[model samples]
Target: MQLNYSIEGGDFTNAGNASSQVKKILKKLNVDPKITRRVVVALYEAEVNVAAHAYRGEIIVDINTERIRVVLKDEGPGIESIENAMTEGFSTASAEVRQMGFGAGMGLPNINKNADELNIKSDVGVGTELEIITKLK
Candidate 1:
């Protein structure tokens, strides 16, 4: 199955919408509880990253018997360094975002911990793209 979702940047009110939808779908599909939880965590991180940094974003989720893959593409100021950004407790969230107690810099690290396969690409001035995949088995 495949699903698509759009996200607006800085919209804290709806940050977890896509992740929640995907979680529901996974539950309905009867995916393994462990795998489902991992996917949801990674998806939520990616979704929040987009909302906290970019101007807009879109998520594409593809699921099959063997694995589930989610792609998040966003338009905003891209990451300057993936390595640094992946470090736990490192974040670039704005003051407003920081005040909300959201950006703890754990997004990418948590995603890496959960997703079996992860890939990220960004252009300094353009935007970013994230691919997270987890094995269903």
Candidate 2:
């Protein structure tokens, strides 16, 4: 099955909607609990990143018998240094964002930890694309 979600930038209240929908689908499909949890975590992180950093973006989810793939594409300020962005305690979120209980600098790191295969591509002034795949066995 394939699912697509449009993430509205700067909408903190709706940030996790995509992840929640994905979780429901996985559960309905009887995907393993562990795999579902990992997918949800990674997807939630990606969703938050798009809402917090991007001007606009969308998440594409592809699920098959063997694996689940999530692609988050955003047109925004674009990450200048993906290496630094992946660090556990690195963040560029504003004070207002931090006050909302996010921006603890754990988004990318947590996504990386939860995904079985992760890839990030970014252009300094253009945009960013994050691909995360988790295998189900």
Candidate 3:
């Protein structure tokens, strides 16, 4: 199965909407709860990142019998250093974002922890692309 979702930056009210929908679908499909949890965590983190940092974003989710893959593409002030961004507590979030109790900088780290595999690419003035995959078996 495949699913697609769009995200608007600075839209805190709906940051996790895509993740929530995916979670519901996974549960109904009888995907293992543990695996479901991992997918949800990774997806939620990615979703929040786009909402907090991008002008807009798109998420594509693909599910097969063996694994699940999610691709997130966002248009915004791209990360200048993926290395630094990956560090725990590293954040570029605005004061307004921080005030909302989001953007604590754990987004990428948590996604890395939950995803079996992750790939990221970014351009300093362009945007970012992230691919997160998890084995179902």
lDDT of each: 0.92, 0.93, 0.94
The pairs that clash in candidate 3 are: none
lDDT of 1 by residue, 1-137 (tens): 89999999988788889999999999999998888999999998888888899999999999999999999999999999999999999998878888998789998999999999999999988999999999987
Candidate 2 lDDT, 1-137, residue by residue in tens:
89999988899889899999999999999999899999999999888998899989989999999999999999998999889999999999999999998999999999999999999999977889999999997
RMSD of each: 0.8, 0.7, 0.7
lDDT of 3 by residue, 1-137 (tens): 99999999988789899999999999999999999999999999999899999999999999999999999999988999899889999998889889988879898999999999999999877899999999998
- The best-first sequence of candidates by TM-score reads 2, 3, 1
Clashing residue pairs in candidate 2 (N, C-alpha, C atoms within 3 angstroms)? none
TM value for model 2: 0.98
lDDT, candidate 2, residue 93? 97
Q: Model 2 segments beyond 4 Å from truth?
A: none
Candidate 1: which pairs clash? none
What TM-score would each prediction reach against the true structure? 0.97, 0.98, 0.97
